[model samples]
Every structure is written in C-alpha cells, then in structure tokens.
Target: MPAARSGSTRSRPIRRWCRSISRTTRSSRIVSTRPARCARPRIPISTRSSPTTRAGGCSCARTPIIARAARPPAITAASAPRRTRTRRRRPRMADQNLIENDEPLLVAKSLSKSFGRINACRDVSFSLHPGEVLAIVGESGSGKSTLLQLLSGQLAPSAGHVSYRMRDGVARDLASLGEAERRFLFRTDWGFVHQDPAQGLRMAVSAGANVGERLMAVGWNHYGRIRDTASDWLTRVEIDTARIDDAPRTYSGGMRQRLQIARNLVTEPRLVFMDEPTGGLDVSVQARLLDLLRSLVAELNLAVVIVTHDLAVARLLSHRVMVMKGGRVIETGLTDQVLDDPREPYTQLLVSSILPP
Candidate 1:
C-alpha cells in the first residue's frame, strides 16, 4: 500500500505538468491569431515601485524605443520631386521711352506763390530729372503743398517760372503755354495724386470709367480696349478686377486711394505730383501702399514731386529732399545726407521732433 501511494503521487505531478503545457500551447495559438487582443498591457512609469510589478516593470520607461516606433519616416533628397527654374519677370511701366532723356525733365526757377499777405510759398526752386523723386517735407502751413501746386501748374506762381520739356523736345514756360496746350500737357504728361481720395477720384463714376476716362482723353475710343486697359491698371495697383465696375464711393479708403492712383497713372504721365499719398490710412495700409508706390515708381521711372510731413516717407521714396518752414526751403540735399546730417537748425529740429523719446 505504501508503494501504491508513491506511484499515485508521481502520477499526480505528471498530470499537472501536462495540463500546464496544454494551457501554455492554447495561449500561444490565441496570441498568434490575434496580436492586438493579446498585446501586453502598458504599465506606466509611475508603477515601477509597486510590489505587483513583475520583471522590468513599466514598458513606458523605454522611451527611446517607443519614440523610434512612433516616429514618421524621414524625407530624403531622392524622394523629393525636381523643381524647374524660371526667370522672374520685372514690373512693366508705361511711357518709359518718353521720360528717358539726357536733359532735366522739369526746371523751376524762383517758384513763389501767395494768398493775400500770406506767403504760401517762397522762392521754392528745384529741378526734377527723369526717374528722379523729390520730396517736399515740413509741418502744416509750411508751404510744402503750395510748392507742389506751383510746380504742377495747379496754382500760378506769384513770381518765378515753371518750365517743362515737351515730348517734342522743346522746353516751354508753363505759364507761357496756351490754356488748351497746358490742359493737354496736364492730361497727357502729368499726373496728380491728392492727399484725399475724394479730391482725386470721381465718386459718381464707376472705378473702371474713372481709369478709362484718362485713356479716352488721350484718344482711346474703342470700348473694348479702354475697358481692357482700365482692368490692367486696376490689376497693376493690386485691386481685384471684380470691383472694376463699382464706384469710388462704394470702396474702402485704401481701395479708393489705389483706384485714384490707377486713374492718374493709366495715361503714363512723364511727371507725377503727390500730396501726402499715404495720409489718413491705418499703419498696415500705409505700409502696403508705400511699398506699392515704391515699386510702381521704380518700374515706371516716373519723375515725382511729393509733399509730405512724414520724414520717413520722404526718406523711403525721395532721391532728394527739400525741407521747408514758413513757406521757404531751409535745407535741400540727397535724402539720406540731409536727414542724417542736417546743416540747418530748422532741419535738425524737424528731424529731432519725429524721433522717439
């Protein structure tokens, strides 16, 4: 009976061993068939100190391996598509040939104007060459705008003569020209950009018509061509062509200013007069407008005479700057030189006033 008990004990252990092997084989088959279902549970790194943790504890502690498995594939030069290079085109400006000349485009001598006893402008004389930009800068009532008016022939100088070289190569006194001839010159050879868009743009007319009117004045009669030219000018100034038929009154301030610019520039005038072109706009709008104006001025090579109280504007756009105070030019020189090293006390004061405290 003792020997029987020993054999039974041995059989019990062998039966248990067989059962354990069978269970392990079944688990292996299940894991092979369904890996997701049998995937090892993720133990957080915080569970590492727990007594229940077996072997190495938290799998999350192996961050390098986990990160490697989760990482996206690298991009290599061989996988990238080849890019073709093309030459960049330049901005096209109208009337390039007409303005390109050896002689100065416009000459002013002792230009002066007055309103009753007030001297609105006094002895403001400067010559503008082709592709040159001159900025008249000062405080309000300082005769900068008046000087611009006298130069553009919008106001007759009380004394002094403004002379412009004609397209036919004849330099004539602006005051001596016949009224009709002067009107023709104003329409074809000169462009005026006012501080107020309302003053420059026709509020009642469609934006397209405002631009096309200048073309019509120059004898562009074809309906299709005039519309096309107007569209082109609007696009050049960054206005959407969809707004071409809308009136200036329906547009925003910046849009109206851009439209006014398009109207004035459509005829490709040799000379342009601007009075505070970026005035009354928000800072962002002013920056964009100034950038556009700079690009257009460079592309067109148009001689410009601009009046502004903003010295920064003068520095950015002008080749030469004329600083005025009390209706007289106090200092005139290259833009950077005059602004950086002022020879006159008034100019020094003007520059210092705009500097940050």
Candidate 2:
C-alpha cells in the first residue's frame, strides 16, 4: 500500500508539470502570432506592450514586433475645432469682393442718332474725361445739339449704347434709363445750357427762385437755405445780391445770362452741356462772363461740352475740339492743335472765319 501511494504522488507531480508546459506553450504562441500574421501584410501590428496601449493579436512575420507609441486620452472637442472654425472664417474671406471699384465714368460705343428721316449723328465716338471740356463745334444743322441731347439722356439713340458708370459700380444705360431714375440720378448729375441761356431759365421766376426751383425739383424744401444757396451762386456769377429776389425780366440781358448760368451751376453738376453759353453778349460782358465761367469750371472741376458755330468760343473754352459739318465730324483734335492746323476743308473754313483781317 505504501509503494502504491508513492507512485500516485510521483504521477500527480508529473501531471501538474505537463499542464504548466501546455499553458506556457499556448501563451508563447499567442504572443508570436502578431509578428507572423501582421508585419508582412503592410505596416506591422505590434505586440510589445506599454501601460497606455493595447494591440490586437496578429500573426505577421518572424521579427520583433513594436507597438505604436501611446497617446493621451482623446480630446474630442479640440479634434474637430477646424471644421467649426472654417465655417466662421469663410465669410470674412468672401466679403473682400464687395464694393469693388467702378470700371469707367462714361462709355459710348458707336453712338448714332436720327431725327425722323435724317441721320443726325453717325457713329460718333468720344469719351469725356473727368473735369475736362470737350467742345463740339459745327455749322448750323450739323447735329451738335442732337449729340448733346443723346449724351445727356434727353434723346434716345437710334443705334448703339451710352453707358454711364457711377463711382459705386452701377452701370446705367442712358438710353434705357426709366423716367424716375433719370430724374433722380441723371438730371442731378447733368445740366444743359441752351444756345440762348434764356432757353434754360424760367424768365418769369426771380433770380433766387430760378435756382431754388432746381432744389425743389430734386426734393429739397428748405426754402431759407435754398434761397441762400441761390444767392451764393448768383454772387459767384457776379450778379448783385440786392436783385436776388427780383424777377429775371427786371434784369438786363447780361444779368439774365449770368442768372441763367447760376441756375445751371448751383447743383454742381458733373457734366454741363452748353449750346452757346457765350453767345449774344457785348465784348465787355462776354469777357467778364467768360472769366467767371472759366473760374467756376476750374473750381468745380466740371466736364463740359460746349457747342458753338464760333470756333473762337471753341478755342477759348475747350481742351479738345471736334469740327463737324453736315451731321458728321470732319476733324477732331486737341483744341489748340485743331484750330492752328486744320485737316479738312470744312474745318479750315471754320478756322478761317476766326482770323482777324
């Protein structure tokens, strides 16, 4: 019985040792599987463990497997800040394009005008620079007036475009402008001086009232300030202040002309069309008025189109001149150059008329 008991004890120890060997073999196999299975597939799945990391068991290749470096706890809020930040930042970048600078002040391309059956103006092309006078000189019925009418938006063109671009980047088709828009944007920016200044003025109204009427037309109702503003321009044009409220009929022809000028000028128009601003006046008054006009135009930096049969008027008050005959411009050049050296016969004739005998 003692021998049998001793044999059982030895068998029990051997069985326990066998169980331990099996367990160790299984653990080594699990650890070795990562490199053999995972390494050769691509980037190796590693089995070298750290306190902060755990990896899936993968059999890759016969090499030492190293784990990816451990990271801190995931901060979910910080990870996605870029997506939220981009939404707020995008509009600031987009707003840079708004209120862009305007292209050009005025662009008239292949402009033409007709009166019933007559081709009054044909393919006339010119650009008016800011604060420059562009004198349009021609014989009677040569379409100077018609061109002005087309340019100033009083008459529609038979063909082509007259586009006025404002400083705010709004392009207005002068030919296509509605009545209210024209009155609001156009009439305020442009003024027309008739061949006879009387044609531009309301002779029945007082001198102050003549200018005050424009303020009224543009929705200004401050009568006290309007009258004072009218007086200021009348004084600028050298009209005596006492006659500010007097009827235009009471003033002499020269005073009436000066008052009419005040009527056109007080609005500070960007462009003014003068049919014959210096016409039908005595030399002394003409000289005075010319000086006044020159000074005002310079001070205000106004762009003007002065139409005159008198080439002298063209030379006296123009930077550039176009000599037109029979509804077509025969010659165009800088005022001094065109007048000194005429190219066409019609232009020569116009120039010849200006020389003293």
lDDT scores in order: 0.79, 0.69
**Candidates in order: C-alpha RMSD to true structure:** 20.5, 13.2
Candidate 1 residue 175 Cα shift, in angstroms, is 0.8
The candidate scoring highest on lDDT is 1
Off by over 4 Å in 2: 1-104, 355-357
User: Which ranges in model 1 have alpha carbons more than 4 Å from their true place?
Assistant: 1-101, 355-357
What is the RMSD, in Å, between candidate 1 and the native fold over all Cα?
20.5
Compute the lDDT of residue 94 as modeled in candidate 2: 26
For residues 29-69, write the lDDT of model 2, one tens digit per residue: 32111112122323322233222222231122112323221
Give candidate 1's whole-model lDDT: 0.79
Residue 287's lDDT in candidate 2: 82
